[model samples]
Target: MDETAHALGASRTLWELVDRRAGLTPDRPVLLQGDRTLTFGELRDGAERVAAGLYGMGVRPGSVVAWQLPTRIGTVLLSFALARLGAVQSPVIPFYRDREVGFALRESRADFFAVPGTWRGHDHTAMAERLGARGVFEAYGALPDGDPAVLPPPPADGTAVRWIYWTSGTTSDPKGVLHTDRSLIAGGSCLAHALHLTADDVGSMAFPFAHIGGPDYAVMLLLYGFPAVLFEHFAMDTALPEYRRHGVTVAGGSTAFYSMFLTEQRKVPGQRLVPTLRLLAGGGAPKPPEIYHAVVREMGVQLTHGYGMTEVPMITMGAPDDTAENLATTEGRPPAGMEIRIVDAAGRPVPAGVDGEVRLRGEAVCQGYADPAQAAGVFDSDGFLVTGDVGHLRESGHLVLTGRMKDIIIRKGENISAKEIEDLLHQHPAVADAAVVGLPDQERGERVCAVIERRPGTGDLTLATMAAFLRGEGLSVHKLPEQLEVVDALPRNAALRKVLKYKLRELYG
Candidate 1:
């Protein structure tokens, strides 16, 4: 990063970062949505007005406000407005319904709630009323506004826990992940530095603003003084036009996003999907090596995948200058000050290249879970957050994730890696997506099961054929899936669309 950006990154709070960036380039655009554009000056002024209106609604410093709004310019304004007031804000995904939404509101003890009213044919206001959400109000079109003069000073401290982000709950209610402005800024700085982005680059936000990535990406734009096109709903058909219209150079959200672009590029192999696009970058779900090769070879863009979670938004990120071998096979190296410690079952440190639980210590790590009980046992004696993910550090400092600890399947007394099989399965011409899961078994404790979502115009993928393919790919005999089940589409959460493996286990097991 440059000295100016480095100085901006040091701002004490999110609102302070916004103010500094806005001061340098007040008229420059920071957010774009179709024909609408929100400049840096407007972002600062508009947020102050919104903060004043929120204050009129009895929202004071330390007040908890929960918003379940889509990815839009208005959402960003509301978020920063809350930051200006120093309010503790909890952002729930817009697509989340009664169960997830109610859980966040209750857990945060929100003094106010913001909804989108009836969005995508669902009445969120009615649902909030039914859930008995306090201080419910709609924030779809015009947000609450008042004079900026009435607004109090922006927050002075950035270390206070002011943001509550929920993890997508598949089996149980989501855990409230606590974060501060400095932690979020550090996470975004890691991502921005790794990507080597510049003010000339135009990015795109195709995911939900309620996601933890929202702030992560927002901080990038703030630090670099660039603009990103906002997509309330991302679909190839509708989103393509906006990318072209705004000249989006950096575009991606996760592995699924890369696959989507590759799928589109395949339709017209001779032409680029987005002529201005040069980089595909994201991190949330696992990225298969085959997918990386397909994107680089077919789509003609540098594909950089990273490893992150809601707890830590940017753990490690693949740089564009990384070797093809490393880019295709491993998640990129961590930035300075972000510690990666691999530990065994007994919580002992393991050497590089050994598979173990990934423990993290960094400025980007969250404070802990909202519930004290949920936060218990999350960190080790060394104060590193014990990520449930299983990965190994290469001697080159890159990260290679095998699979989640829960995804490991022990069949016939032999532990098997689901990602090992799934990564190989993705190379199959007939498979669009595959999930390897463990099913309960009386004799062996658990049996390996492969769920396949076949590619278009492909024939049936039988267990025998899948086994033959894995064998051809050099998978060991004991690791072969015992059963195969085909599905139209795998279950996924609204944000990031990460595969809901727990639901698959519940259905198949």
Candidate 2:
């Protein structure tokens, strides 16, 4: 990690650019949270007041502030507020449970906590007391306070740990990924170029602002001098109306949100409220090809898929002009200002068409993990972040992800990824969703297990039937699942998205 950093502007931080934009696009909509709305100027002013308020509460620069808020106007302000003051913001996802929340708060050693006075109909005042964070501040609304604001001076010529975010603990303990102000701004630029965003565009975000997806995308729009409509949740009934109301052209969210929107469209035939909507993008997990087809065919909106992680957020994204094959298979090529390589277990670069661990190094990549020991564990001798994903990069610079290095199913001798079977499960007409995982077995170290969610009124999601379908799909004998669990819905996080295979492993495996 270099000690010095500089924003591409050579003189501005991300918040400074956003603050400048607030004055440029003063009357334009900056955020839309249920019944509430705020323009760019209003959002900036609100963030200033909130920053001032946080400062009065003794939130000095370099303070680790834990923001435990849901998606909304206030959440956005708190993020920029902390950034503007040079305080590090560690966000607790709104859907986090006691264990997850407690772990993050304690591990981050937060100096202050911010939350909505009320969230998702829950009283945050009571919730914060239970969570136990210092200097709890209430984010009421986008109103200006007459109190004097305290703005922290910039880092000594070269520093920016503006925020510390962790991975969505799908596999192990969340790795704290730190981003400097310069790197965060660079990340937004990479995403904006890949998405072809412009100042004339209007974006509607559904993924939580606390994570990489919303903050990166929202910053891209704001930095490019565009307007954005922020939503606190992914309620289809409300999201559709909000998009139509704001004439939003870009719809950003997770695979779960897009899947739910498709499900809703099927239920309510002939509902075209947001006809002017142009694009729909999904991330947070590998998207099944079927859902991609339905979104484009039915809604007549361009369907874009993104693949990234916390270590090197925005690694690969499907460009606006990528071919269907490129979009469906690879996660598009590495965006500008990024470099990628496929290497074997020994860390030697591999030839095209061979699977190996993917390593990435670039401006978008983080300097190191927050935990020194964790950083030593993942960082290689050559200073590259070893992403545990098993994939191959072609000569054309496109990548084909075979599976994850850690998610492979080991049978008697063969190693396999559950993604192949999950893709096959999507081929089933009655199967709404599926996740394949490896379960311990007495006979073979580990065996395959499939957890499936069947559509309403659909029956016969039996283990034997699914096996037959896999066989028909040409799955090998050893690759077949030894057990199947059909349920009304798979267990998911607060976002109502499923990827917690570990949770299922505890329940059924």
Candidate 3:
């Protein structure tokens, strides 16, 4: 990290960081959305007023508030307002419906809830009310406003669990990953420093702000004093003009994002998709080596992919100065404070160049899951978080992720539990057995594929029917299977008779 960013990153709390940045560069824009701009000073001032309004609404320090909103300036203000009030804030993705939203509210025990009312043809407020959420309020256009004087002192402690993010971790339901302000700062700081961003660089947020990457990107902007264009709904056609308007120098979200831009670039053989775009960098799902080479060769820009998750947003990130071979093959190296240890199946540390489960010990690691039982056996005795990802560290220290030990499918950087989908599919009367797996895709990073064994004499099933059934079962739309294959029987082990998912992947992938 640079000396100035390192010093700014030392702030104890996110509120402190905001205050300090506002004091230094209050007039500089921190967030840009269409014709709207939120300066650093306005962010601090607006959040304070919103905090006072929330205080009047009975929110106190340690109060739990859950919000399900899109990528808008108002959502940012609301989130920072919760921070200013020292309230525990949980953000749910906008696409999440009753099942996921209800799970987040119940698990977080949210005292209050924030919704966008109705967005993208969906009624969020109605969904919240239907789920029996407490203290439901809409936060779409204009946020609550009040005098800043009514607010209490901003939080001083940064180690307290203030953020609850959801992720499917080898389970049937999403787990609440607990995080502290300091831990998030550490994660974002690593990302900012590794990317080597500067004040002159213009960034773009083309993904859901409710994801863990929201705070991670916000911290980067705060530290580097840069502004990023916020996209509520990202589509290639709609976002191209905005990128040009904002002069986006850095663009990317994951492998999917890179492929989208590359596809656009290919539309015109020699023309740049976005004239100002210079670097495309992100990480969530695995990046195929060809995607990296294609972006560099075809897009005429730098492409860097990394490794991250909801538990730890920035683990290792590819730097702009890294060798092309390293950038194409590995996920890059960890920052100073992060410790990556690859271990064998027996839990013994393995030497470099050998594949094993990747474990991490770092300040950026989350406090653990909200459910105590879910956290059991998550961290080893040495305090390293046992990441279910299997990878190896090269001699140059770049990490190469081979595969995952967990049964989660990452599609467009979102973790989808194969078990969750399979369990839901098993409930169908015509289905005898089901297995879900992720297949390689150039655009989505991975596409969900469900292979099923039909009950004898049962009619054949189509993907559309299976999807409608899952939707009726209250499963999130994003988790619905994209491809379906009917099989006579699922391949199984001879001894235990356990379904072998690898065989399904080989057959369908």
Model 3, C-alpha of 457: deviation from truth (Å): 1.0
For candidate 1, lDDT tens digit of each residue in 1-509?
88888899899999999999999999989999989999999999999999999999999999999999999899999999999999999999787666567889989999999999999887999989999999999998999999888877788999999999987422234689999999999999999999999999999999889988999999999999999999998888999999999999999887667877888899999798899999999877666688889999998889998888888999999999999999988989999979999999999989999999999999999999998988998899999998888889999999998766655664432335677678889999999999988776643436789999989999888999889988776565656789899998999999999999999999998
TM-score of each: 0.82, 0.76, 0.99
Listed per candidate, the RMSD to the true structure in angstroms reads 10.8, 11.1, 0.8
Q: Candidate 2 overall Cα lDDT vs. reference?
A: 0.70
lDDT of each: 0.88, 0.70, 0.93
Lowest lDDT 10-mer window, candidate 2? 1-10
Please give the ranking of all candidate structures by lDDT, highest first, separated by commas. 3, 1, 2
Model 3 over residues 124-152: C-alpha lDDT tens digits? Answer: 99999999999999999978888999888
Candidate 2 lDDT over 208-297, as tens digits, reads 677766567766766665667777666677677878877788885656566666776677667663776777775545565666677777
Instruction: Give the true-structure RMSD of model 1.
Output: 10.8
lDDT of 1: 0.88
Candidate structures ordered by TM-score, highest first: 3, 1, 2
For TM-score, candidate 1 versus 2, the one ahead is: 1
Worst 10 residues of 3 by lDDT: 1-10
